[model samples]
Target: AQSVSQHNHHVILSEAASLELGCNYSYGGTVNLFWYVQYPGQHLQLLLKYFSGDPLVKGIKGFEAEFIKSKFSFNLRKPSVQWSDTAEYFCAGLDYGGSQGNLIFGKGTKLSVKP
Candidate 1:
């Protein structure tokens, strides 16, 4: 009973441009991946995470992510983007066993940076 899907709800850029956001998850076993960002009022900030070896992971401002275990997918990249990176991009998932991490979000992707 795990679910997390975000195929871009609203994303409009201009400042610098270049940002990809598309995360999908249905879980098969152990999973822990997240990419949260909220800058308009600031609070949630962890632009990358994939609790495992390393299927490509990087966090912070210049975000990056790639954990494609059989296409469960975890995609969030930014080659070039500014205007404070605008914000509101959440794609989280945590289902290890007993389920206590308490994070299964993905109904947000509002990034509008027109400067």
Candidate 2:
């Protein structure tokens, strides 16, 4: 079965600090990468995703992700972070291009951005 691994379980940062969360997947065939964020008491929202075309994909809130197929990594990055960005970030992989409806999620990385 496919799986996603987040290197950091928790991250703490100050406002305006740069952020980078590592995400690696274990899928051999075609796969879709996604970054989801869940704020406190809020449902999961799509931050960014990469299925095809350009490897660099940008998302809302000045967030972006780069898909590196050779490295099996789709790391999320933001030049500057804010306190409001504090939330649980998840990395997910859709196997076989989402054909079988199998989505493997990571344990998630809790980001605490201090004001």
Candidate 3:
């Protein structure tokens, strides 16, 4: 079994400021990492992911993450954030490289951006 950890419980920022969310997962074998976001009342959306090959990966809406195998960390970052980016961010991990079952999720980090 694997476990995910999000060190940031809550973050507050102004529009256009940079943002970074830390995510760490514990697993001995090969694992897949993800960052998911949810608006106030919307369902979870995939922000970014890492599997193989590139350690640095980019995703939709100007979001990116770097996968550090030795540190077991996959941190999410955005150069500039918007008020619309305000949402709850979750870190998840799968023991294997496949998404066959439910993802082990960390308690979400809530981001509130001031417009």
Candidate 4:
């Protein structure tokens, strides 16, 4: 079965700190990757996506991720994170050629930022 798993359940950091959240998926076929972020009291929004092309993809808010097919990983990264970055991050995917385009998401990674 296809699924996603986020290694970090929660993370705490101060302002201007580097951030890296692990993400892994168990799918053997073509997949469309995505990272969605939900800020405190805000709706979920797209952070990044990898459909077809280069493995490294950049998204809004100075965030980026690298898709390694061999490892079945798409790790999110940020050089310097801000207090505003405090939010829950989710890694998701859709099997392009599978039955449906429904998204498969990980439980989530909660991030806390202190000023």
TM-score of 4: 0.95
Query: lDDT, candidate 1, residue 57?
Result: 95
lDDT of 4 by residue, 14-104 (tens): 9999999999999877778999999988999999999999999999999999999999999999999999999999999986554668899
- Model 3 lowest lDDT segment of ten: 94-103
| Per-model TM-score on C-alpha atoms | 0.33, 0.95, 0.93, 0.95
C-alpha lDDT (0 to 100) for residue 31 of candidate 2? 72
Clashes of 4: 0
- Model 3: how far residue 43 lies from native, Å: 0.4
lDDT values, one for every candidate? 0.87, 0.93, 0.90, 0.94
RMSD of each: 10.9, 1.5, 1.9, 1.3
Q: Between 1 and 2, whose lDDT is larger?
A: 2
Best by lDDT: 4
Off by over 4 Å in 1: 1-14, 20-33, 45-67, 71-73, 77-82, 86-92, 103-115
lDDT of 1 by residue, 20-43 (tens): 889899977778889999888779
List candidate 2 segments past 4 Å from native: 97-99
TM-score of 2: 0.95
* Per-residue error (Å), model 1, residue 109: 17
